[model samples]
Target chain A: MAIEVRIPTILRTYTDGAKAVEGNGATLDALFADLDARHPGIRARLVDAGELRRFVNVYLNDEDVRFLDGINTALGDNDNVTILPAVAGGSV
Target chain B: MKYDTPLEAVGNTPLVGLPRLSAAIPGNLGSDGHGAGAVRLWAKLEDRNPTGSIKDRPALHMIERAEADGRLTPGCTILEPTSGNTGISLAMAAKLKGYRMVCVMPENTSEERRELLRMWGAEVIPSPAAGGSNTAVRVAKELAAEHPDWVMLYQYGNPDNAGAHYATTGPEILADLPTVTHFVAGLGTTGTLMGVGRYLREKVPGVTIVAAEPRYDDLVYGLRNLDEGFVPELYDASVLSTRFSVGSADAVRGTRDLLQQEGIFAGVSTGAILHAALGVGRKAAKAGERADIVFVVADGGWKYLSTGIYTAATTEDAVEALQGQLWA
Candidate 1:
């Protein structure tokens, strides 16, 4: 299954500055492993200690993955994954 | 409708049904042929508040709580970090309460927002656009440290912020629509989501709380390493069932859809909430489940009038015109 993952600007150095990249995995943990296989050391930035980094947010089709099973969230073909840094919100 | 003070009228906004928009969503044909128990959309018209925004509830509640506890006294200066609405609400309340108000806002916010703050006699300090509200919060904290006399009502961490929503907004929605299955709102300081989400979760069985977070351009995260992004202290992920990051273009499109389809003119952040609400509505419809989705219209679009998003001929042109600027 192919899933397109959107990369944040800070992590672009791993994807050669590509805004998005395609990888295959049934779950987020496996997807990151797949991404690291091709991108080299990118998984370490997103995951550590067998969990997602505190500052790194991974969303599957815009819905936060943390609520949906975290790294174990299921993935499917044509799923759009987005990675972003944790930022404070104040749209009041 | 009679109140001794404007602050007394901070909440109790009307909840109106969006029959047209709800009927527009595609659902299973087999569900109650008349569309009964299918799906419905309800909008909490928070723009009708005294300050024309939902933030008035928290701003007033926070200030009053402080005043009642003696943390805020006569001749005290109030401080906060806001995008616009909260500052404007606080400024108005402070002016009426005889307290000086100062706001640290992002430089990227609209000019109209600045004018509104100034109109209410609030001093505006513009933080760098690099990190948006994150920068504003940092700057506000620094300023508060320099002047120990200034009372920063720090919305992000203050429990009173969420308390306002829990005490008023949540009860109002439950009273107005007992059948509400989902609650959606913009995720900012996470006050609204936290307070209302907690209240509804306790009162309603199997209620879903959804968050629509604004996804800004890279400039909002400018030069910050991956570890630098900040999360609100009040944010409890357990309070939210799911969260969707809505980009500016989608936000604008959602705003236009509300205006065109439902005739509700709301701020860009509210647009993000509506977009997420509709997304959930679509999924529920596909599942042939009954749903009453209520989303907050945080404020009117007047503050963002200069953005030309509402009058633009097309959503693409509107979004293109919105580029490089923070809409939410």
Candidate 2:
């Protein structure tokens, strides 16, 4: 079984327009490595210096990975990972 | 219960318990499986405010702070980017205090919000709906530059916005439910979370501050995903213990459940907040720990009635009906 990763509109270019791609790893770090193997250069946009990029947000099963273990957050077989650029949020 | 004016009656909303819904959660029963009141849910009914949403707290506070700081004065124009509630609250306050109100709102927000803003004597400028409130904020910023005299009490970054909750909402909650173990609220400008989170953290030991963020691309009105490129300046991630991305489907289900089971009619964002509240409650129940989780009922269902969420035959249908329109 593999983890499902949903890509955002801006990052879809890295996935060749594929909205979602599957990767296998026990932890998010390994999952990005697995994904980078198939989709080269995609990991750079999401991570820098072994940390999640400033504007990029990755969620595992709808929970923010930042509050988890960051890039080291564990991944389950059926986990859903979503990657999106940080945008201004809220009704300010 | 008595106030000098409607503007004076903004805060001190009721914090009511959700007994029926709390008991309905399966694992809420005690270890011996008899008592079902260990895990409880409470709603901070911010809908009871003057403008019918929690925004009233921040809107009034921001404006008042600006006034006290000499940024806002008599006959000054107040500019803000709002999905709805903040504009309405600001407009009402401005009208009463003799200030002009201009709101830059998303074009896709419900018509009810537009009419309400107009009724409150505020001019509305429509921002693009593609990027949601992000676009609105950008437009407001551009307009603020052009109108130098226009005081933009930017709620997203304003300290007083969060300060409102810290000074009032937090104290009221602690006073009403001193045992509150967790505080959950919809993640909008992050004012509610940051302010109340800080206040609760200072008093309540190990209080879990949970943010019920709308899932990216879910289009729940008045809520934004932090990853969407615009984290409100007021949003301090450290203040939040954890964040839950609630989708339209779950938000719809939560709204319907609150209405059906608890008879609490609230907007879609409240549904998302309640969903997170229940999530943490379930965790506490499973661990057999007593918890008092309080979530914000941001607003009433009156403005959202036109969206058909409350009357839809099923939650799926309600979610489907909410597409393309901002339901929160």
Candidate 3:
């Protein structure tokens, strides 16, 4: 099964400027692990050493994994994972 | 240990229940009978500070923390990064406390902010506008590394920024609206949300916390991707019950509506919170659910007078042009 991992614009530099990448796995952990193998520094940035970054969010098919089972959250075939780096900017 | 001026007491801002704003959304959008009286929303109006912005809270807290730890001394120079408010507030506070201040900021910040900072005697180092606050953060970090004696508050990573809210703003909210069901704020340095959100969650177990964020990848038009990424270290996404992105146009329109309907004049970020609050209110109402949406008015509208967000539009073309630059 192919899982699509979406890369946010800020982390594109770590992904060879790729917006989305395909991974072979039925589970999120497997998919992320495989993706991390391909991009050495990505897991560190997105997932930290073992825990996810406090500000980074991984949504599987538009549903947050945190509300589900976190790293164990199941991912179906053709599922899309979006990475969002939370920030806001404006005058005063 | 007596303070010289009363402005030093600016950190403890009040959090009041916004019956008007909350009723307008929940009462009108309620689906179930329970929604008529269940959720309570409070607004932690940071605009009440002397500088007309919440930045005064963190600005003063950071200075006090540094002074307590012997990291800063009287008459020493202060260095930090800001989009605008933090620098301006720090400029005012440092002037009052008798500290020399230098701030690294984006070049395209509003003239009002720049002039106010200058008026408070701050030396401004302009960063690349395209780089946004990240560049300012980077410059501040570099400056701190370069200077050994100068005190840099480092608001981006400084726990003191969030601590101020945790100690003062959060307690104020909990005290004013003990029944607060939801807390909403812009996820800026994450300090505001983290500080207040953490406090509210601890004080009120079932409190729903939400954050309004700009689209992390693109500009307001849903075009032009943003590559520069910056998230404050203090922000923990897990604490937020819901997070949504608000476009600049919607934020601007919300600010306009807030002034026209509620008589609450706030900054652009507050407009984002209001828009988010309305969305959350409607969702809860549509489901026959009741919830309170507490949002923060980060600052007053005095700094945005040049943008004309609160006035009548002379032309559609001119309004569109101004809208584009208002948040730019």
Candidate 4:
């Protein structure tokens, strides 16, 4: 099984316009590293100095990684990862 | 149940149990497992407030605080950026206070919201729909800068926004349900989460505060660089135990479920909050731990009725109707 990472529209340039890409790793950091090997410079936009950027939100399944273990959060091959830009919430 | 004025009834909303929902979800045995105590889901019906939304609390509080501090005086012009509820709330309060109200809102919001604001005597300025409320906030800021006389009670940065919940919402929830184990609410201005989260932390030990945020579709983020993403200044990560982002489809499903199962008709954002509450409750139940979870219903379903979310044949059909609109 491979871990699927869904890319946001703004970050699709790293994946050659593909909406999602598959990679494998035991943890998110390793997964990002593995993804970077194929999709270069994608990790820098998501992470800043070993931490997630303030405006970037990453979710595994439906849960936020920051609440689990940040970059060290464990990843399973079947787990789906979603990356999104944090914008002003539309709860009107 | 009596108030001298409509504004005086902004809070003290009911905290009712969601028994049917709780029983349907498996593994909801409370810690002690005593007659519905095993698992409980409480709804804080902020929809019962004066302006038919929770924003009434913060809007009234911010305006009153400003009036006290000399920032807002009689007949002053008020400016704000809102997706819907906040503008309606401010417009209601502004009209009563003899103040002129102007709101910067995204062009994609519901028609009922615009009518509601106008009905309350507020002027509406439409911001581009690409960035959603973030664009509205930016436009409102520019307008404020141009007109120094206008009092922009910026909800995103205003302390009173959260303070209102701290003083009223938090205490009301605690008083109503002292055993509340989890508090869940939609993440908008972040005022509700920060204010109530802080107060709950101080009063209840080991209480969990969760924020359920909307996952805007690509159209909402259209052509915008990552640098342009907006996070409210009122947001402080430490106040929340965790956050979840719900997509539009799930929000619609949850909204329908709430009305169908519990007969509680609430907005789409309330569904997102309910989704998070149900998730945590399910987790606790699976672990054989008892919990009392409370979620906020930000507003009634009236404003969104025009979106066909209530009468659509399928969730997908309902979702399609709200596509690119600020239904979240």
How much is the lDDT of residue B109 in candidate 1? 85
Predicted candidate 2 versus true structure: per-residue lDDT over B221-292, tens digit per residue: 223333447778898999999998777788889999999998999988888888989999988988988898
lDDT at position B219, candidate 1: 74
What lDDT does candidate 2 reach at residue B286? 84
User: Candidate 3 regions off by >4 Å?
Assistant: A1-92, B1-4, B11-20, B26-40, B216-228, B312-328
lDDT of 3 by residue, B221-312 (tens): 22113333566767677778876566566677777877776677787678878787877776676676656567888998787777766674
**TM-score: model 1 vs. ground truth:** 0.97
Please, what are the lDDT tens digits per residue for candidate 2 over residues A48-82? 99999887788898889999999999888889998
List model 4's recovered fraction of native interface contacts, to 2 decimals: 0.69
lDDT of 3 by residue, A1-92 (tens): 88888887666777898889888665667777888788876777767656567667777765557766677778788888877653435332
TM-scores for chain B, listed for all candidates: 0.97, 0.95, 0.87, 0.97
How accurately is candidate 2 docked according to DockQ? 0.49
TM-score for every candidate vs. truth?
0.97, 0.95, 0.76, 0.97
* Candidate 1 chain B: worst-modelled 10 consecutive residues by lDDT: B28-37
Native contacts present in each candidate (fraction): 0.70, 0.48, 0.24, 0.69
User: Compared to the true structure, candidate 3 yields what TM-score?
Assistant: 0.76
Which pairs of residues have clashing backbones in candidate 3? Answer: B39-B292
Model 3 chain B poorest ten-residue lDDT run: B216-225
lDDT by residue for model 4 over A1-92, one digit each (tens)?
59989899999999999989999899999999999999999999988899988888899987889899999999986899999887888464
Residue-level error in angstroms, candidate 4, position B234: 1.1
Model 3 interface root-mean-square deviation: 5.6
